[model samples]
Target chain A: MATKASRAAARMMIAPSVILLLAWMIVPLSLTIYFSFLRYNLITPTGNPFVGWENYYWFVTDPSFQAAMLNTLMLVGGVLLITVAGGIMFALLLDRPMFGQGIIRIMVIAPFFVMPTVSALVWKNMFMNPVNGMFGQIATSLGFQPIDFMGQIPLLSIILIVSWMWLPFATLILFTAMQSLDQEQLEAAEMDGAGSFSRFVFIVLPHLARAITVVILIQTIFHLSIFAEILVTTNGGPGTASTNLTYLIYVSSLLQFDVGLGSAGGVIAIILANIVAIFLMRMIGKNLDA
Target chain B: MARAVSNRTRALNTAVAGTLGFLMFFPILWIFILSFKTEEDAIRAPLEVLFGSGWTLDSFFTVQERSDYFKHFANSVIISLGSTFVGLLIAIPAAWAMAFVPARHTKNVLMWMLSTKMLPPVGVLVPIYLIFRDYGLLDTRIGLVIVLTLMNLPIIIWMLYTYFKEIPGEILEAARMDGASLREEILHVLTPMAIPGMASTVLLNIILAWNEAFWTLNLTAANAAPLTAFIASYSSPEGLFYAKLSAASIMAIAPILIMGWFSQRQLVRGLTFGAVK
Candidate 1:
């Protein structure tokens, strides 16, 4: 029974959050778009004159932009593949009745809580370092060469580190979904003489479809803008080898002080993120209606 | 629907799951162990370092002595708590309204709020940095608090809305019918009912803000540097000091890790925006 008075109060109550979020979103975004067209460099004290599409042209034509785009896709795709597969396997094992289930779940989910910088550094120096790292020590003791992880395959190393952090997230969500599956359906399938593989394929997987999609969409949003890990580990080093779009933009705008180029890159990143956001928003929108 | 399983099967499952779980958790466990070792022993072969190292709190002491650990820790506490507090202040009213007295466009508003979160922070980094610089807010805790508040507002509102929606409006209407004023009804009825949800929202937001690295690293230089920035500084040649690095990391993540453990179930709900059950 929303009367006129209560409806007015509702409007009043929602105004602060709505207006603040509007300002937060629109103001800086418009400014970024405005800066993308201008030739602005913090280091050079020249006037920021609008240069049409020149900044975008240069940023796009730069070979590094292509590399960053490729690396971004690879990193996102690689981590998604690893985490989703690993998550399913872990979720299945965890769903089975076992001793110390709580402790095992806690251990599996621990990495997700470790901040990116700490996780990256731990992986970089303690585990992946070719010389003084544990891997190196083991390799040397075993009369073999220690694989230079970050140096040899920077993106893959990053992929592994990020996957470790995210696998728990996927597993937790999927496991929750698995726990909610209809037991009668599984019993029915078993009674029909279906093997475990067939039951999993026909029953459990279908039930987990929504949760899998949720995990993928949510993870994609976060994975697309992976920054701190790359920053602390590679700094997109060895000449743009590990630079994602976010890292590329950071280097241009903040590190190199090329505001125009960075803004253009930012716009591109926004567009890329929006492409995925559209799918996510639609999915959530449908869920809301349901 | 109960199925009987043999004891051997149960033991085998436990052993396999435990081993895999330990493997997954070894990095953090190793860091925890190393944080107590001498610097020289921290980098030794894993087997030797685990079995032969003399345990000491030297690294913990040196971390604080060398790098004013408390300052960064305080910064993290202030920023994360401050942002969550401000976000709740703004979001609670909005979520309450949408939940109880939902307008026709309520779903649209919710989706719009979430869309802002989807806008990658990098996209607006240049302008926000310049704006902060012009306002003399760079490297300040207030700036971080403001940014993080905005960054997390959508999630907070979404979570509170989901929680509040679970609360039936008929209860409030009945309270009103019993002659309770609107303010009293909210204070005495709705708020008490929503406490658990709000507490979980606060917790998940704090964890998110505490572990936030991108904005914290980019915005703060020295004075307002949080644990994220503090730990990132150790990423240089000094990162070779495995024991000290481990100590710093353990300190940085300890509070959030505990909080995260408690909030894991809520985290799934919050992160997915209740899209999944």
Candidate 2:
């Protein structure tokens, strides 16, 4: 029953958002792409000569680029492994017939609400600091030397902090999915002499496969650009020990004043994120039809 | 039918889940406790910090007095609320149109909006920063409000679209049949029906905006700094002041935490773009 007038109204209603989003996406993005090919430095104020591939070459060839790329992959990979594994265990536990389920859930989900800066600094100073941190205190009391967490193993430390924040998200999603599981199937498997482990393996896992993928893909999108946690805690310190690609770009562009180099890095980041986005969009798109 | 579990099994599950939950929540719990202690007492070992300290609100007062905590808190309130408000205003019409009068390319449009979210912020950081610098929007609440509103517009539209889709078309049709104007139909029927969904969207967006650290930290320096940036400034020698840092962190996160608890279900739906449910 959509007449021409209604269709015109509908288009009018959608026009503003469409136009604004179009501008938001295209303007800055084209600027980034254009600047990537020019030797533009804010501090030097030199002539903007077209330097095709030079910025990309330097950004890639930089020693820190390799470290940042490796660190970025490790951070994302490590946090995913921990969150997914820990989330499954938590989801299974929470899904059981247990007392105080609501309270336990509230407690578990609290960390996800804590801002990144707060969580990072809390972990850095209160738990991981060598001198006055809780870990140090426990170690000294137990007759052991306190290990320097941020100093010795910075990336791993960040992974732990980030994992703590994200574990709740994974658990909540998995738990919601688990709750929708078909009880009859589990009972059928049980009646067929399947043990609890086998029931979880055969029946419940398949049910949870989609949810797990959702968690991994969604978390990867956020984790790949973990900027605040690293900024607040490590500052990518100890000589590029914990710098991710995002942080590397921030360093080059904002800190080091190399707009062209940073824009090139930004372009690389967009490409990397787009790769992940393609898979994620496919998954979400499949779900849309379902 | 739900199976009856043994009492022993139920108790075992309770114990296990409670212990694990507490373990997962210990850092927040620890900070909450430390926030009430004196600075020196807060730095003591865990056991002593827990038992040996006298409880006081001294650090809370000190944090306010020293850093003007209320200024940052106000910035967070204004920025988060402002962004969410602007986003909802822009998004409601777009979502409403897409939901009710969807054309062939509606799905593509929705997906395109989502793809914008996946574009790493770092990708556009340079141009946006320079734009802000040149336009004198740096470190201004208006600048942050504009940026965050745009940043969150896609999610807002997706969320509102999903919610609006759940609404039956017949209600709007019936309203139309009754000779209600389009504006009256939306303001009276569609809006009331969509309030719950919109509330959830607002809550989730506020939580996201409040905890947003990267842009808030990078774009603002002092005047318009939100609590996220405020807390980050403590990441120095002064951060060694455990009680004060805890107090500041608690104040910064407490509002969002309470709001977050209410929005967990909506959060899953929104963040996953209705993919899970």
Candidate 3:
């Protein structure tokens, strides 16, 4: 609430953004919620019967639902692990005042900036080609037949490529956290005769606790919707070997043209995303309090 | 004493950092070299391909002929910049209200906005696609812009709000006390103080909006397709065009890749701001 002058000011200030965000949030979302309750399909007219929760029931009962769920969890879990672990190590290296640090950072960060479609394509062809990819070439040079990254280990290949793309982001965020660590605290710990591991565990990790949480939550939300890599590299294929929830929806709705089932799957994905969001919000809430 | 310790540790650090650098950089460097090589050389041994063969631009030519690079580029520029501009226009005022006024629900509201981001787009893809069709937004730049802006709005607002919070409330209050119009306060004072933060936020959001693929691919068929869609087309029905695809990938990613390269410090600074502090 504002005084007459201030209220007008506040309203005026906020009106444009409020309207835009309102439109942004309201239109598509309400349509989604509406569609979730109906038997709608792109191939059919919009006048289809309102099948209350049948779409949801159909979606929940599908065989692919469990696989997609598991795949989503696995990809998020796997990518997060690789990124957080690699991020920590790389951040440690980057935080140090070493030779050519600037140039090295530019190189390390290039992948994160590369268009995902392009990077996925690059990995699909130049690196993971299996016939003439760099990986295949390396394998043949070592006197072994090239293993098809997409065919032999489809999900793992996607996971590795996605992880490679995000690891730099993790490192960048964590490295900033590491740099902001209090030198005085470190010296005090050292004065108390703490070893390197002790200092890292007690001092550095504690200092990084917030950043770590931020990294986990932010990366979790984004990685759960991993689409471009699957589309580019595997097409959710080698027989649904790489289909996560997102790809499943795409296949169901676009490829298979089943909007009812796809909408249901989409609702499930939102619920799963909300679970993560709730956990993140609690962390943010707790942080705000402290 | 710490200087001497830093010096002593520097050598070991350099060795570790060097290896990490090389491993991290190898793929990008390899792709860079491949972008210039003929299809034949691109498939050769890494050692010889790196040193043995003279580079050619045939792949680039093939890419140019196949994909209209400029149309895709224009689409990317329009979508990314449009989203950022639209996002900021809305965010600035909303952030101003919360930052200046003591609203009880401001935190909850902010959290709610961000939570929308966590909702997987796939979950709502069907509905959104339907809505776009019903509204005649499909295969239109406006549809891409609105979706991208919405998709990115939560983070944009969060980033802008965080920056806005840093400006001392006393200043905004003083502007109120001075009878400076809210417009004056925002345009004349608040914006200037926060432009650096806002500029970084704008650049970072452009990058996020630029790299977005799911919505662009899903919502767009042909008319509104961006660089991501451009690259996606190269993975064909008969087989993947490995060499030409790389060149197309190179062409598609080069603009934003270069943008990111130039604006690394700013992007990282904005992304890592609150967590670091």
Better of 2 and 3 by DockQ: 2
Off by over 4 Å in 2: none
Candidate of highest DockQ: 1
- Residues B1-277, model 3: lDDT tens digits: 2434466577788778887778877777777778888777777888988899997888887776766667878898999999899888878777777667635666777667766676788877877787788899998899999888877777777777777887887887788788887678779989899997787788889888889989999888777899888788766634446567667667676777777877776665455435444
TM-score: the better of candidates 2 and 3: 2
Which residue segments of model 1 deviate by more than 4 Å? none
What is the lDDT for B69 in model 1?
Answer: 93
Q: Worst ten-residue run, lDDT, model 1 chain B?
A: B233-242
**What would the TM-scores of all predictions be?**
0.99, 0.99, 0.93
Docking class of 2: high
Model 1 lDDT per residue over B1-277, tens place: 6688888988999999999999999999999999999989998888888898789999999989988999999999999999999999999999999998888999999999999999999999999999999999999999999999999999999999999998988999999999998799889999999999999999999999999988999999999999999999877854459999999999999898899899889998899998876
Chain A TM-score values, per prediction: 0.98, 0.98, 0.93
What value of lDDT does candidate 3 attain over all alpha carbons? 0.79
Lowest-sum lDDT 10-residue window in model 1 chain A: A281-290
Q: State each model's C-alpha RMSD to the native.
A: 1.0, 1.0, 2.5
Q: DockQ rank, highest first?
A: 1, 2, 3
